[model samples]
Target: MDARDRDGPDRDGREADFTWGQARDFANQLIQAHSGKHLTDLEIKVLQGSWQNHTYEAMAEQYTYGAGYLNRDVGNALWKKLSQALGEKVSKTNFREALRRAWWQQGRSVPSVPPSVPPSVRPSVLPMTPPLPAVPLAETPFAEGPVAPQSPFYVVRSQVEDLGLRSLLKPGALVRVKAPSLMGKTSFLYYLLQGVQLQGYATIYLDLGSIDRDILTDLGKLLRWLCARVSRQLKIPNRLEEFWDSDIFGSNDNCTAYFEEYLLQEVPQPVVLGLDNVDRLFPHGAVVEDFFGLLRSWHERARISTLWQQLRLVLMHSTDVYIPLDYNQSPFNTGVPIELVEFSPDQIQALALLHHCSLDRPALAQLMAAIGGHPYLVRRALYELGTGSQTLGQLLATAATETGIYGAHLRRQWLLLQQNPALWQALIQVVQGTEPVSLSPLTLYKLHSMGLIHRHNNRVMPRCTVYRDYFRSMHRADSP
Candidate 1:
């Protein structure tokens, strides 16, 4: 008997034979076959949540886990594993369709055809493709937070990573990774920390961006928080009281003594401390100088003190260091500076292929022309295209519109600009002007850090065609 005889399309004339329970079972089977292990409880929650179109934040609220841990750490690995098992690209947004196609391919159910259609003209549930080699669709996991160290989607900039690792291994090393927002600076640091760990070093990765504003403003609280976090990562007992004395020592001195007497001494191997989004502290005028100056002191001491040499620092930030400090007290100028640049065309092609998007040279060129090899933007485009949801032409056609794949990101940039009239006007000039526009140094830095415009020498232009087109259209619409 034909599958259509048992299960037919719903009233809407679309197939309704597939269900979420069936999807879960199919996923379980594929995952078990691939990993020889069953899904965890949290994994099931994510699977169910994704099936219901629930965002990671929603899942976290419902299930009581950190959204970052669920999305970046768990969701990233889960989708990649599922993609590998299914031999097709899978993500939270597209997994439903992917599973439906897979189920239909397994002869589970045929899509119900309309009786009006001719007997010989019935369509298959999905288009058939050639039996090609399985792509590492897992490598191209969803581009959330920082790209996981295990992801193949990470494109290494030329020799920059090697320089970072080399610098990280040196005694008293200070490696600074600076890039505009979404340029993969954090992802690079993730990989760098992994590499350092493999070399018998104790590694601690912290994202200062997530620190609370209240703690940020208080020097004493911030120092204690930093020490407590480091101790936790190192699995050592927190002894801040024994080392900290407000009347006897300044916050910086207390922080130093805690590290020198406690953290540095507890670990047998050298320690590589990775501080991501360190610029988060920049707004706290009182805390920023003392904290950074302390780091500078540590780096200087490392030159002569073996105990201090055991500590290596990796600071990653998305902005220029505009805060003033005495020349000898600043840590920014003395390190191996690794500034991440936008992905090159070849690099973008490599990442696209990882996402199973075998875009041809011309198609790749078209994408580059629109987005200019921005890592996050390029990955997002490939992800959408790989899902078989839209053609390259369709994506590019809707690229600058609010309904397109990049709509949320574009809207976020717009909202941020709208909050600051000066930044808003500055961006307008860059987007509308035929030649590169000159702006104040601070204004230029802010725009560049926001990833809205590219800086060439001292002049600026809209980062890419997408920004140029979207902002230009918005400017026109907002005008008389």
Candidate 2:
């Protein structure tokens, strides 16, 4: 018998002689061939662990280190080798795909293809061909699992570049990006910062999500933190100490005055300040108003300053917190409000390509339709598809249930609706009525701001079918 038959039959009864070392060597050879860099012993070990589909936590446990440490070390080591080989930096997450491709190259059995699309729902467009190269595994920087490539995490091209979002970084422009959780808000901000830096603008990314209402009570400290963060990011010399020693944080007015006079005016390059999760600052209106007013004041001063327009601000937030300023007057409202909508068909296709999935047009369309373009939902559905076991109908039904990413988000919203019956009533009226019921202006505004309903043709409408059905079910169950 051949060596393959001598070893044993795989679960499928096919002759196989696959061993752990064989898998490692196969992965190494593939990396060498594609990446042109030799893997270190540590990297090979990590790759072997990864090839076995071990979690970072598990790897850490095996190595007696923290998961984060193992992840970072392995990630950095992989990135170093990939950069040396490819002559460009490859992100940590994409490395997983490289390993998968290596397995395929080694004559190992490939995962089964997903079932064919139903004839009734075939796509109008032809299938995308393989001429488009697969995104090298080492280049993707997100985590690996059976996630759909169409998910937001997969759609992130790299840390420093995303052509779709580059325009938001123009000097002195205001931009607002909104999405629900796991839609890649933080990742997008990182990309935007990288983009702005490439354009010779300085960037400071602040996560206001961690700040509380009490922080707003001390506006001086807030401004000081902002100034120091900007200074450090820009490599401005001793910026925090300079501001502190100069008494910038002594009082609210002192901080604002110093920001307008020194940091804003004296900065060497155009500044792009990204305030992520700005909704946390909203509960303290005084702080929010003051902080934004400082930005507006500096923006006006920018036109007259000897330096180029000095500063721009981008605010990222979820739908929970509302910004009460009028669009025309507010700095965030003045420039452009770009709602990072759900993934487009092309983006989803890009994801499939990245994951090396053989998704045809009809299959792609069916996936998008079921998820309603929500990013996390799309990812979860694509993940299910990647497994090549579940049916499209099963994936679609799960997309609506509470088990997948989309379902979890829906459950959160459903629970919120249950807590606030007025909100529930408002949603029901908007969904079931042919004409928009005239809700109290405050209620209408609040719901719209919360993303529960959207205005269309002077009428409020429910945001999604899931929400509509939720209220409909409640309404029916209550009927007696």
Best candidate, TM-score-wise? 1
What lDDT is obtained when candidate 2 is compared to the true structure? 0.57
Runs with alpha carbons beyond 4 Å of true place in candidate 2: 1-125, 128-171, 179-182, 237-252, 260-267, 323-332, 356-358, 418-420, 430-464, 470-480
Q: Write the per-residue lDDT of candidate 1 for residues 1-480, one digit (tens) a residue.
A: 344422232323443556555566557656765775545546767987887777999999997789999999889988998899889988988777777677666633345455688756665332111112225655446666777654445555636866887788789899988876778888899888877775678999888988888888999999999999999999999898889999978999899989998889888899999999987877666678888888889999998999999999999886533323222332347778888888876566556655677675567768988999888888788888887678899999999989998899888788777867877888898999999989998788778867788888889888899999999998898899
- Find the number of clashing residue pairs for candidate 1: 0
Whole-model lDDT values for every prediction? 0.77, 0.57
Residue pairs that clash (backbone atoms under 3 angstroms), model 1:
none
**Highest-lDDT candidate:** 1
